[model samples]
Target: MQRVPKAALLGAGALAIVLVVVVVLLVAGGGSDNDNKNAAAPRGGATQKQGNGDQGDAKPDASAKPSLTGSALPNGDLSNTRDMKGPITSGNVKDLQAGWSLALGQESQSQYGSYAASPVVVKGVIYSQDLASNVSAIDLKTGEVLWSQQYASPDQGPNGVNVGGGRVYGATADSAFALDQKTGKEIWSRKLIRNAGEGIDMAPGYHGGLVYVSTVPGNNGKFYGGGTKGILWALDAKSGKKVWSFDTAPTEKWSKKNEDINLGGGLWHTPAFDGSGGMYFGVGNPGPFPGTDDHPWGSSRPGKNLYTNSLVKLDAKTGKLKWYYQVIPHDIYDWDFQNPPILTKVKGRPAVVESGKVGYVVAVDRATGKLLWKRAVGKHNGHDKDPFYASKGQYSKLRLNEEIYPGRLGGVIAPMSTDGKYVFAPVVNNSVTFTGQDKDQATDGQTSTGELVAVDLDTGKIKWKVEFPTPAFGATTVTNDVVFATTFDGVLHAVSAKTGKTLWEQQLPASTNTGVTVHDNTVIAPAGLAAGQGQTPAIVTYTLNGK
Candidate 1:
């Protein structure tokens, strides 16, 4: 697959939140081989007998009936976002097929680029948002085009798509779009700000009856207001009406004028819901803009920016700020804390684990937003001599730059898969560059090479790390015994979840940006260029056969 030419026209904020520090303890645990060995073992004699003589000797339990309809879909209830509901279980595994699986739209050319938004699966239907402010619905099983509807602003970049409450929600560069899930018809559209220049980078998160979206304004192609001021909106899911809005820009006069000061700390990734009415999300970089004196430095700004690069928790129902943990105070390296925050129980403790551009994997208390543990999963590089203050008094110097393992874009960018026993992180290699004066420099460039890692969720210890030949830019999926990942190089790979060994591999025409989704025995990959060039972008489906 070929990389698209750099489009310098518009700004879409970086991905992930700031890197927070956590203390991790290494411990020994069960191995992948041990798990596999037990799975393949024969069942007890009584269970075996029941299976063999099943005919008329046993009656099926009423509660065990196969479900023909989709289970109750998840509402974007902050408290319940982490709870597993419906047919999508965290532990169930299924075989996947791979081909020109599903087609949503004709390839279209645009100035910004092709499509970068990932699609969503809801109740067997696939929902996608493209460059234009529109969302399309397709049949997951048949690849049939169901319907497509356009939102209000065509120029708005619909970066993320989501489905809930029998409604489809899309987050555009300028606003939010809500559509009828069944008809692909627009229900209502709301614009937080008009043509703010910098496109909002996050997908909309739905919880309870509210939709959460973020935006960045005052981006004049310079570094000052070019940085986000951290604007978040909560809207009524059914009506596209604003419920509440929060701003992270500092209220002090001196701080607002310093371009190096925290100007914009907008949301870059979709907020995660805890299913219990709580929401979790991250913020992005501080700015002087792209080319200006607003660069983040000790002398440039005197104090830490509130919520500039931090993990924030909000009441899902009321849009109330609960607690926050700053990952990087007064961030200078363009490290945005906007990655996915996954909620899982680690070592029996309910925790939120997240990755960031700073190359760290951190776990925090989901309810209280308290730090539990953190580890350097990738390489870190930057000025480590800067003095800053945390909740405690003052620290003279901290290690800001350590050539860590994973760079930005995460050791894993996609949401992790877990069986409640282990977490699967798809690894990617990345690099960074810094320029400017010795004290203040502009940083850019991150390259990724892909790999897969299994970690003990409880201890934050690596059970195994397996590298891929090509870098993966898409998402990942897992079932029973296997894990799946697709690369920008137009390839799909299947590996033993237990052994970290490759089970199958297949090549496609273009980069796979949407990741792999499984339906029954087939695997689906959405491949093609966002600009509608080179290889024809189409969905490929695959299935495995007995040798």
Candidate 2:
């Protein structure tokens, strides 16, 4: 289990009031092996217009007025905006009452692995999967299982699911597969990795007639050594045939220190697609986790690590590189630029925005990959320092007291919300220390806190902010007047979109680490995996009752 470092603000004296959650669930203890970002909270039943219909039908009409306000479908598409305009308002969010809750998956020997992947609701049925590779289609209205099916062997379960073209798409550690949207019948499955270590932990992106999948073993355990690689694959959606593949960690002949270094450029989230069919995605950190085993801190895998720690744009039709933006060069802090880049227009110029675990949100020209503007959304005290390590087997070689902010876990792991004009990104402000190899030696030296920052899309300016008790680990969804966010501490806060003021909140039984789904006038989210609780995971739903 990954040890969560304790933290407190260094000097900010309680600058705000602590909001209490009114709706609480009775939850037991459990945890997830993977510390993934939660899905956005369910938006109440609100039907919004689709952007230019589907990408397969035609390109997004450039002249069409963008759907700047109101509720849109949640997680139905993989652009990763996390901003599906919903109908939930600050005025009515308090009226949200629990509807029903149901557990997902088979009984696991260990309770730690819950549904890290968010459930995708299509045609009134919820498509969800467990770590054990069990996929089910449930009735959205009655919270009853409609049809349950497992993605046979070689499938390690999916990190998340996406829907399009009358099919459900997902990827496991070693493969990417599709299922019939109506029946859970196996459509087709393709093996992504033959090697042992590398697997996929991303949701597949489906558009036109193609499916995009990413594979890596970067987060399997600790960075071991070289020989492992990350890859991006594109396939025909109709038939599971390879269209093309790109090696994220391609070999570079210019860097001398590249010898014997394991370069890791894993794509951890769903890739974003733009109006013109351009694909955008972020790369994870290069490894050896601490850099002590390879060529030393900042020295191994020399030179930008090519595509790692970078935002890459690809041609959706041929899987060719269109442009690229490297967020940080030679990263050693495990600050992977793993969040999906959200697409939008700035001043009528097409642009894409992305934020990672570094607390930096950047906007770049969508077609050119040129940096437009970048902003540090929160307190980022971290500066690259020489990673220290003693001889193997010696605890004295470790830097036990070294504090790094925008800590490895700080930054924006959760997805952001947008109002067409502004983007609400969640940031965690905490510092971390490397006590020993995979060992927990010290607690957080400073307080671990976070803030919900609203960024003006045009200029990357801070519009407003609201501090949270803990890091917001789930996606933030928004309507016209309200913005919703969830914390690792189990509280979901609904704040005003215009003023960033807290309007309502509900205390869940366990922390939400997956996106919440609000469709057809109902709100549902995964409320499981309470630390040490070993609780069974379930998808809980709510609606505006007695309205």
* lDDT scores in order: 0.49, 0.59
242, model 2: CA deviation in Å? 1.1
CA displacement after TM-score superposition, residue 275 of candidate 1 (Å): 4.0
Instruction: List model 2 lDDT by residue over 375-481, tens digit each.
Output: 88767664532322211223344354577676655677666767668888877776657554322232333455668899988999999999976666566766657
Q: Give me the runs in candidate 1 sitting further than 4 Å from their true place.
A: 1-96, 102-113, 151-158, 217-228, 248-254, 259-262, 289-291, 294-301, 381-412, 437-448, 530-534, 543-547
Candidate 1 structure quality by residue, lDDT tens digits, 21-60: 0001001111111011111111111110001110110111
